[model samples]
Target: MVYQLIKLLPIKHLPTLLGIAAVLTSALVAPSAQAQTKTHEGWYQVEMIVVARKDDTGQEHWPSNIKLRYPGDWVELKDPNATEVPNTTNNSASATATAPVVDLTKEAFYLLPASERQLNTQAQKLQRNPRFEVLFHNAWRQVITNKKESKAILINGGQTFGQHQALEGSIRLSVATYLELQTNLWLAQFDVNVGQEITQTWPEIPLRPNYTAATINNLSLDSEVEAELEQALANENPQWSNGNFDANAAAPEANNYVTRQIILLQQERDMRTSEVHYIDHPALNVIIQVTPYPSVATTPLPTAQ
Candidate 1:
């Protein structure tokens, strides 16, 4: 009956009827298409490695390794209370499932095609015009001890020390977009000490972009307190070097360092999948890769036998 009604319609009216029919068809098909295009959101495995060089002529070295999982909920919520747990999965088995690890020792890592054009472009710009060098220089001077006078000797024709040490580390972040995954940002920390042998120094390096000199200055007090605690522990327990001292006495210093590091890490910006970013430093190189976690298949429960 509907076909007969349409067949009896005038030729001019048929075009209008067809247009309405087309609209109805599109309205019916739109939802299914939208449903088929799933929004890709999930936890991503983030791996970062800290590579360093002692000096300009020294070979590269890897001093630190970090692995963590970034949950989709945390990224979406952007809440400070959200906790990021560690990811224990070994990512080597499935190539398609996760981002490949960047080995800094190998030359191929730097040669890999950049996942995002903007990231590549920004990195080049930063390399060409580094505004943070002055900040780095000041931070290095504050942390590194200068022993130029201690080693000088006028009686022996003014002998001096020529040894120096350099430290560098960077953080790379990748994120996924609507069309593809790419690197978003890079944060780097670097330090160098030029003098005779001195005590090991823990440089107050910022892992986040907003980390400021004032915050580092405040954190310096913690180091002094830590040193006092260690000295007290050593003096009170002569056998501390032989492992006879109370471990409880060292808790405060350890806790202080860990807490501060956690705060710095928490301040870092979030990243997504396939984004490749690097923070460049004279002494340190950090590369971070972000990739989606592989989906696990759920097994169906068997019916009662």
Candidate 2:
């Protein structure tokens, strides 16, 4: 009777038995609760293309169009139509030549008249403009958190305290030096030369060690950090030849450097105090109240009854 019952049981039950055995095996192979986060899992690739320019004060202007892509995230490239050329390294004859940085290696320096004219034409267009422009659009902006709004005051006339007063509104004052293209054009030249070196070094510094994006103000810092950065940049990209780049150049060059340093210092300070979002956004643009102090009116009102 037992042999007859076994024969009646279907042979297909063997596969079902194997499936149950596999489930039990997997259950036994599961991991424990002691695992930690791995660094390889944390590494995210982000890219920014910086186009450097000089301001009136000869400070470096790093305007970039950045794009970032993560395995699970989406990124919108600033220039969707921008061309992509694959780098080839296999053949010596076909090896691509690195284009020399024309802006830096160009024979004539900023002091030359032709360089001044080129910079002035561009600087004038940037100044007195209050529009917001996008630098990069990606999930990175959500991560890095740089300030999008400008903090610097924009000079505009408004009525306050029963008289006309200068209102302090916000504008896209060059993150670079403020140069009047006409009389003080040389100031712009000085910024270009020195700024080039500074911008290059800025990326080298691990601005954020912990993550792909970091807030510089949040970290504990030395008082000399600003001065050190400025000096390092000056030494790397000297304005003039000889052992004395500062001494050889005119007073305006030094002045421009000093002023630009001040602006940069202020920017650093603002990054700490103000709501700065550093992600992919390039320009510092924010709307601030230009509260004009009440103007003092000499015109006396008739005696009140």
Candidate 3:
């Protein structure tokens, strides 16, 4: 009946009716297509790799200045293997199923799995390179907030040195008009010449402000602190040696000069989401990428009555 009515209409009117049909078709399809595209605003998956170059000749010599400290507001990445806590609700569950309770106590921030890491190929290349030493590699997911609300994440790896680390510090991420990454990392070198003899390598590192912990200005790496720490180690473990440390093993001499020789890698970089960024230094290098995390509907645990 509608086809018979259209056949009776004038040819000029048919063009206008056909145009209206096309407009209606486009209106129906446009919204669905737009909804399918993911929007990135809040959370992101961040991956980072820190590497030290063995070929850098300048690192072999003691630096003219030294100080090392961590940022005051730094946070350790949540270990997923340690515990299972719910961070999302079961909104996607069927209407027939009981509504799962959302835990208010569970933190919104946590580390994702190693399988979620997208930079395994880059890490493998660095590990395989003879000139490079892979110090720290981590991938975690967290909310990216503005500078005022953003907190720094601790970056630590490599060998241990009496409550300290061979590589220890923090990297911070914040978004203003753009996403930015700030690195305040240090690589601690043991004295190959410590307890041997006061040679030219034993250049005294003067008192310097540990400005690496940008949030804390009062931080200082004093010579007195080093001397006292050395004396304590001397009293506790005479067997303590440089480079290689065995807590049980006895040392041949009193290694009193064991402290941090700070080789810092500090930089501020503005980044775009999903693009890999490289921050390089003479002593160390960092590779990082931040990608938007898709909003996922996770099944929540059933609430107890």
Candidate 4:
């Protein structure tokens, strides 16, 4: 068959034909120049599922000595049900701010409905199995930026006891050459035993690790002074990064969780669009997908007659 096919085409022209085919294939598979430049700049819709294993008979051993605590800076996920608070100033004594406004990135970070989740089928399959019990699942949208600019979104679910939830921590999504996911979450069974102290304690840290404290508070300092202050703070506290709100618990809050045992799930992963990624533990498991979503639609031109 190979000999017959080669005979149909002139041997002298085979090199040119192959070269043309290669160029056409590259055009179809490779991304355009514009797309290559903006891979990490645009908005992305993220969906995830968290499930616990009912049976870990054959699972690998996990370390129990490792300590787990919440990160200092984590932003609360924007609630879809809640209205946006406008940053309005009173123009007159009698007038009040009417409308709320924010940048496109912040506006796009709203949580999506469960119906919009792409992993509904996957969740269902896990639910049907006897070895797995679905714990929590949700979907949201945001503008994913580089590692230096990305914010850690606070995540909490499962049974609520007093002021703490069974599952709590933060998920930070960043793009440093590639999409990176960092999860610093912990699962605990809590009780209402008041005054009971736990070993875990959260250190008071800045809300925005990427920004300076003065910037977060809107305090303007001399460039040299700010730089010196940041360096001093960094030297004092290793966790300090020239690093949001009451709901975010970004500043400081009461910790009322009473748990004898806490299981920590800390892992970092590199992911690609349109593919499902899974992070597994002996007691907990996570399934997630991050897809690029455009705020505006693109329509192709009509074909020529």
Candidate 5:
């Protein structure tokens, strides 16, 4: 009956009718796609803990006693900074003793869209944005635990110790895609502090005195790892570096370092809510988790009396 009705319709009207039908179909499909995307995008609460551990003849210990924790949440890649560290002063009985200070390397977490091309572009823009510093400062905060034992300390946002600086490194956090694009994930970059160097005072004695020391070193990314990250970014968006090659010529080496780290995190595993993921580096161990905030239904406002 429908076919007969269509046949009876004017020929010119058929084209218009088909176009309307196509539009209707698209309108129906578009909302479902958008809704799915929205479900994936939202504020996620995160908890990250970093600790420095050492091993001595099968015994483990925390030498630097670094048990730093950061709790935060964000809705978008460009969301406000989620961490902050309060300024603190050490009080000592001896007037001659130097007052200790703690400093945190401020950092912001960005969720890279699934598109590799967009990741590169966003990465460049994020680095250039002055607000990123503020965002980072807000996301990461330093809390003073033991004022007496604590000395001059620097914490890296990258999760690894800085070169020649004790207990100073960086941590890079982002949401990305993983392995064969099979999963949407959260990733982080940092050097994992494992064990320290030990020196024995009396080697010939049965019971010898030994000294355990925390080894400070910069996190090094091998060429193979760097190439893998570069390839992954290129695959996500084939035209990532197409138009403005020379414009980025003077880009700092740190930018490339961060880009590589972002890619490395994505390659590790899919991110799940409330599940902790540990990435081990030679100088530190990083523990991170992502949890979605519970949605609350809004109630209707009461009418004025």
Candidate 6:
């Protein structure tokens, strides 16, 4: 009877068992194969624009040809003509003289191929970036009413009503025709609190603010300040300033040295921002915050034309 039962089972079960084993083996190996295949290529370039509001109110608009490149392949963007300095100011006096050179070129990047170009086009053509409605405020009203919790007569019952307010803003860029290619949306809001380093709540590394070399004055420091600064300088580097020189008397010399060093750094930053390197193709409109990384703390802003 046992032999008969074994024969009835036959060899067909072996193939089924083998098939199940094969499937389990494939499942175990597939994830590693996928992981081995995935890698990120280096950053790419695309085109972008800097659209600023022209009027005091957010109504009227004017389009200027600003040329910028971003990451990845995207829509072809045209470079605008050169820019001119509109205004220049100085502490001593205001002059309409030669405007300081401000390179407006910034490197923009994007994914190689966006999922949908139509959406991108629609956003640009409509002069509005895609945005989500954010309910920031809720309004409420209260009415006087009374209801007896005890066995006494229930005086009254009231209901409260409320509404939500949504905050929305549009992107502005004018062209000859009332058309756009796509919308670039920035849904996130970042609170940037600018204050002195000592009073900040969050841990922050000191960063130099944006300013031109000429902005810093070349005048000498006061007697007391100069004396302290001279001492500090001597402690750090004896060769930077002569220790024997009278602090009050050498105020002019100390001031000139400090001022020139600052100016040099400012100029260096400006030069880096101004340098333009070209690639064979354009990139897509990838958005990255302009905030500098810790390592690049002192790097100049990208020239975003």
If scored against the real structure, what TM-score would every candidate get? Answer: 0.24, 0.16, 0.58, 0.55, 0.23, 0.15
Instruction: Identify the runs in model 5 with alpha carbons over 4 angstroms from their true place.
Output: 1-39, 56-165, 176-269, 294-305
List ranges where model 2 is wrong by over 4 Å.
1-86, 97-305
Instruction: Pick out the ten consecutive residues of candidate 3 with the lowest summed lDDT.
Output: 27-36
Tens digits of per-residue lDDT, candidate 3, 1-305, equal 22332476566445433332232232212111222233334767788888776666353454635555555566676565555544344655453343334322233345555677877766776677677778887787667777766777777787533344567788889887568899888776654224454433333322222212222233232544444444555555565434333323422222434543567777798876776665545567777888877545242321211
* Local accuracy of candidate 5 as per-residue lDDT tens digits, 156-242: 333322221122222323333310111112122322222223232111101101112334232233445433434444555466444
Model 5 TM-score, 2 decimals? 0.23
Ranking by TM-score: 3, 4, 1, 5, 2, 6
Q: What is the lDDT of residue 87 in candidate 5?
A: 32
Question: Higher lDDT: candidate 2 or 4?
Answer: 4
Error of 5 at 66 (Å): 24
Lowest-sum lDDT 10-residue window in model 5: 202-211
- Model 3 regions more than 4 Å off: 1-41, 57-67, 84-109, 192-194, 197-257, 296-305
Encode model 6's per-residue lDDT on 1-305: one tens digit a residue.
Answer: 22232355436333322322232232212121122222121111222222211121122121222221121222212122233464545544555555534222232211213331212332243244222111111111111011111011001001100110011111111111111112322111112112213321221111112211332243344544445555555665566565464434332321122100000000000001111111000111111111111121232322222
lDDT of 2 by residue, 99-212 (tens): 323221121111122331212322233232223221111111111111232122112221111111112111121111111000000000113233434532221111111122
Worst lDDT 10-window in candidate 1: 136-145
In terms of TM-score, the best-performing candidate is 3
User: After best superposition, candidate 3 residue 290: deviation in angstroms?
Assistant: 0.2
Off by over 4 Å in 4: 1-39, 57-64, 84-106, 191-258, 296-305
For model 5, what is the error of residue 265's alpha carbon versus the real structure, in angstroms, after optimal superposition? 11
* Shift in Å, residue 75, candidate 6: 29
